[model samples]
Target: MAKKQGLNKKLILLDLVFYAILPYIVWNYGKEPFGDYATMLISTIPGFIYTCYRFILEKQFNIAGLFIIGSLALGTMVNLLSGSAEQMIWNGVYLGLFYIVIYFIALIVKRPFSLYFAVDFAYLQGYARKDSATLFFQKGIFNWFQLIQVVFIVRGLFMAGLTVFLLNKYGIDGYGGMLLYKQIAGWFFWMLITGMFIYINIPVQRFLAGQQDKLQDKKTPLSTDEIF
Candidate 1:
């Protein structure tokens, strides 16, 4: 739990640095050649590289690597074709669509999309009961992850649509104005949705945790090797 919280904190800090501080710097200093676009790209590069590094560390090459490639390709294409900040908004839409597709794929495969979270939860449930943990992984964790993915996809799509609508309604010509509006609206929307998700899930999480505890109490203790 502490480790997970630590990871979450790190992610939060990264987001603050990337989305808030870096965007501000770019908007102010980088208006000429590439405008805010250059700044936005530069700011996001660090996080993108970090994510790739993290994925490498975890030995999960497929999804993260593909995502990075796709993003770079899309970003480049958007920049080259439109040369407008508004085009970059498609990245969000692409991601949302990608996740939605993955969600459906998971359903088709009878696998839960949230395998990572379930694996972590299994570890948290205890390390001494490998078989039970594995069972939970196969049966339950994926479903929960799929549900979360659905939630994320739905929210992301809405945000993407809203972003497009706002960008079109308020042209990107008013550079600073559009940037401010996007920053404020994006932040507020994410915060609101995240808060609601947390608020709604707390009780559900507790309930699940309690159930896991009861199940764990009945399982026989085993060695790490045996469990694993």
Candidate 2:
């Protein structure tokens, strides 16, 4: 059986430092010295390097990792190419819109991305993809998966709306504060989503284990006398 991996506290701390703290620090402090455009570009460097390092360290060659890498690459490219801080901020809003569209399309097709992500997680925890999918689609549990997909869409929209508000209110000068607020908001949503997932998963996992035990019982052969 493949060992199930849990959240790494150390990595989470490192992520906060690199993704949120360092970036905010760079944006705020670097702005005067480097100017808004250059400061914004430089602020992205820490998060990009940390993300790549994490991807490599975890040896994550899976779809989830690919998605992260792709998004990181795209964001990096946007920052590099964008002529001004304002453009870079707007580009981020556009990317969020793009992701919202993809989520909506997945919902329309009745093939939510959240289901696939859950299936992938199960696969990592020693479940076969087919088996996990079969279990995940059980009528009782499947609705939650769809709900998760909706949550993703909502999250995207919420962040996009917040970004627009910040941009209009503070403009480029508020970049550091925006980054901090976004991080805080992101953490809140993430916790809510994770809790929701765990609530559904515990009972489903127990049922799966019971089914597996029954299968083992059926496969085990009795001695001749005992059978007779």
Candidate 3:
């Protein structure tokens, strides 16, 4: 089995720095020299470069990686095409809305993306994809996976509303504030969802462990076999 590459704390720290802190700093300080639209564009550079670097470093060619890169590229295109600071922000809001719709559609079809995300993680941890999928779909487990998808939808809606509220209230000058508040809000929801997942995953772990034990018992030969 391949060694599992668990979460990297350093990469996460860098992500927070590049995505949240650096952008906020650039928007605030670079605004005077670069102006609104230009600064907005400049602020994205660090996060963009960091995301690409991470993608390449991790060699993330999976669906998750593709989604990240695709979103980044789309966001860059939005920034370039946007005429003004407000338009750029609004475009992001629209993009977020589009994602929310996709999630909703996935849920309606009963093929929640959260399930696939888990399967991908399991595969990384040296589990067979087919077995993981089968286990995940087991009666008590599948519903929780759907709940995870709902959580994603809720987070998306919260963010979209928050962004619209901030943009309307703060205008272009409030970009820095938006970045700060969004990061705070994003982290809050992320932690909330993560906790829920941990709580749910405990049972899943037990179930999987029990399954493994059963498999081992089946594999072990009976003492009577030696007599035969």
Local accuracy by lDDT, each model:
0.57, 0.84, 0.84
Poorest 10 consecutive residues by lDDT, candidate 1: 113-122
TM-score of 2: 0.83
Worst 10 residues of 3 by lDDT: 1-10
Q: What local lDDT does model 1 show for residue 37?
A: 60
* Residue-by-residue lDDT tens digits, candidate 1, 120-181: 43455564345534544543344554555565556556666766776677655444454455
What's every prediction's RMSD, in angstroms? 8.3, 4.2, 4.0
Model 3, range 137-183, lDDT digits (tens) per residue? 88778888789889899999999999999988978888888887887
Show where candidate 1 strays beyond 4 Å: 1-11, 36-39, 49-84, 120-133, 137-143, 173-228
Q: Following a full C-alpha superposition, what root-mean-square deviation does model 2 have from the true structure?
A: 4.2
Candidates ranked, most accurate by lDDT first: 2, 3, 1
Model 3 residue 93 CA deviation (Å) reads 0.3
Q: Considering only N, C-alpha and C atoms within 3 Å, which residue pairs clash in candidate 1?
A: 112-142
**Per-residue lDDT for 1-228 in model 2, tens only?**
233333545665776898789989998788999989998889889988988888887655456677788889888887788899999999999999999999999888878877787777778788898988888888667888788889999999999999999999998888888988898888878877887788878768777788899999899888999988
